[model samples]
Target: MLAMNYRGPYRVRAETMPDPVIEHPNDAIVKVLRSCICGSDLHLYHGLVPDTRVGTTFGHEFVGEVIEVGSTVQNLKLGDRVIVPFNVFCGTCYFCQRELYGNCHNTNPQATAVGGIYGYSHTAGGYAGGQAQFVRVPFADVGPTKIPDELLLEDAVMLTDAFPTGYQAAEMGDIREGDTVVVFGAGPVGIFAAKSAWLMGAGRVIVVDHVEYRLEFVRGFAQCETVDFKSVKDMALHIKKMTDWLGADVCIDCVGCEAAGSALQHLTGVKLKLQGGSATALHWAINSVRKGGNVSIVGVYGPTFNAVPIGNAVNKGLTLRMNQASVKRHLPRLIEHIQAGRIEPHRVISHVMPLEEVADAYHLFSSKLDGCIKTVLIPPGVTA
Candidate 1:
């Protein structure tokens, strides 16, 4: 099997690797058909996340066909086409029972903070991801869902992470009727969050990013206003002015640790590694929302602390909510939205390449070249 091998920071390649086999009674072996390079994957590519061991695969958003299943895996079988969520969790644990799948206690060694994440790093449980020909799926019954007959493979792969994550960001906003919502970052998750805000009764939606292509894309996709923060002298003040000086009702920080804005934040967060990741977006979210409003965060960040505006948040009485999306918990509604043509997930896809070209795929996405919004990796046996 050929898998994406992590050599070091800013380096990944397609290398020959042993095929995965069922290792546990609940484990299943999936032959990956369609997999995506998520925005969060950039953290691993840039070596931002801790404990990302070399030679480990890095992918969590994938859909595949089941080739083998262990004795205890009853929910799935050979030949089943499924979309596996990014989370690797046991369904019966306390957090899982409460639908907090991302914090499942039974799957990860570092279970105090985050549960096992496929291909993330050792800190999230050193489970290999699906950026290859085959992947081992633990607790298969609880995570993999059969792709709906009406859904496209492109959309199914996105549902594994981007869509559910974006939707969860909106859900956390607690948006009220006629509220104004502003989402920072115009990546796929931000795009979906902006669109989902409309579904949740937000009267207005605004997406912020410095990339002109992304801003233009989200404006059409989410039917929302756009803000190029690079053009504004004071981004928070701009948002306040857009919201009639009170500030937005809900502000979402979809840009996590790798966020680029001020030179100071970039130097301290990215270059110095003093903070977990850049907290620029978080700073804006905390300072730009109306008093007593909500701030929803779905951006991926490391476990370490980053410089944040706690004093401003406390003074404004903001409700801050954040967590990894429980993908399974939101699939049904998202599937309905996709089937009904309300949200077209595949429209965001800008690049698709073979699995063997994983190296180039990473470069394209990481560099943000070719107007690349999303990239999908198709295995050898899979058709485009």
Candidate 2:
């Protein structure tokens, strides 16, 4: 099988690797039909996430056909096309019972935080992702949902991670009807967050980003206002001004560790490895929301400490909520939304490249070239 092989920071290429086989009783081998390059994958690509070993594949959003299944894998069988959630979890655990699949205790039990994630890194249970011709799916019965016949494979793939994460970001905000919500970052996740805010009855949705193309894309896609943070002197102040000086009712940080804009933050966190990725977006979120409003975070950050504004948050009495999206928990409702045409997840896709050219796809996406918003990789023989 050909897989995206991670060599080092800024280095990845398609290389022939051994085909995956069922390793556990609940495991299944999937022939990947469609996979994606998520914004979160960039963290591993840039070596910001810890313990991302060389030779590991990096992809979490994918939909595939079950080629084989183990003895205990009763939910899936050969020829079943499924959307595999990014979370690799045991459905019966305490956290999973509460519908917090991202924090499942049985998977990645060694860690005190985050559960198993496909192709993230050793810190995320060292599971191989689906950025290849095939992938091994553990706890197959719990995580892989059959793709609805009415759903496009491209749309179903986004539900595996980005769409769910974005939707979860909005849900965590607890947006009241007519509340003004400002989303920081215009990536796929941010765009979805902005879109979800509207579905939840937000009166106003604004996306903040330094990239003009992304701003333009989100503005058109989500039908919301956009802010180019690079054009503003103080992001927080600008957001406050936009909200009539009281600040937005809700602020979301969709930009994580790699956020640009702060020289000191980049120098200390990204360059010096002194703290977990830059907290620039987080800083903007904490200071840009109304005093008693909510701040929702769906961005990926390192496990280490960040230079966050705890004092400001405490002083303002903000409700800060964050966690990896429990993709399994959001699947059913999201599927209904997609089937009903409430959201078109595939519209976010800007490029579709063959899996063999994954190296080029990574470069194009990470560099933000060719007006790329989302790139989906199709395996060699599979036509999607």
User: Which window of ten consecutive residues has the lowest lDDT sum in model 1?
Assistant: 261-270
Residue pairs in candidate 2 whose N, alpha carbon or C atoms collide under 3 angstroms = none
Residue-level lDDT tens digits of model 1 in 266-335: 8878877788888989999998999999999999877777888999999999999999999999999999
State candidate 1's TM-score: 0.99
RMSD of each: 0.8, 0.8
lDDT by residue (tens digit), candidate 2, 199-221: 89999999998889998889888
**Candidate 1 lDDT score at position 283:** 90
RMSD of 2: 0.8
| Candidate 2 weakest ten by summed lDDT | 261-270
Candidate 1's displacement at residue 379, Å, is 0.9
Clashes of each: 1, 0
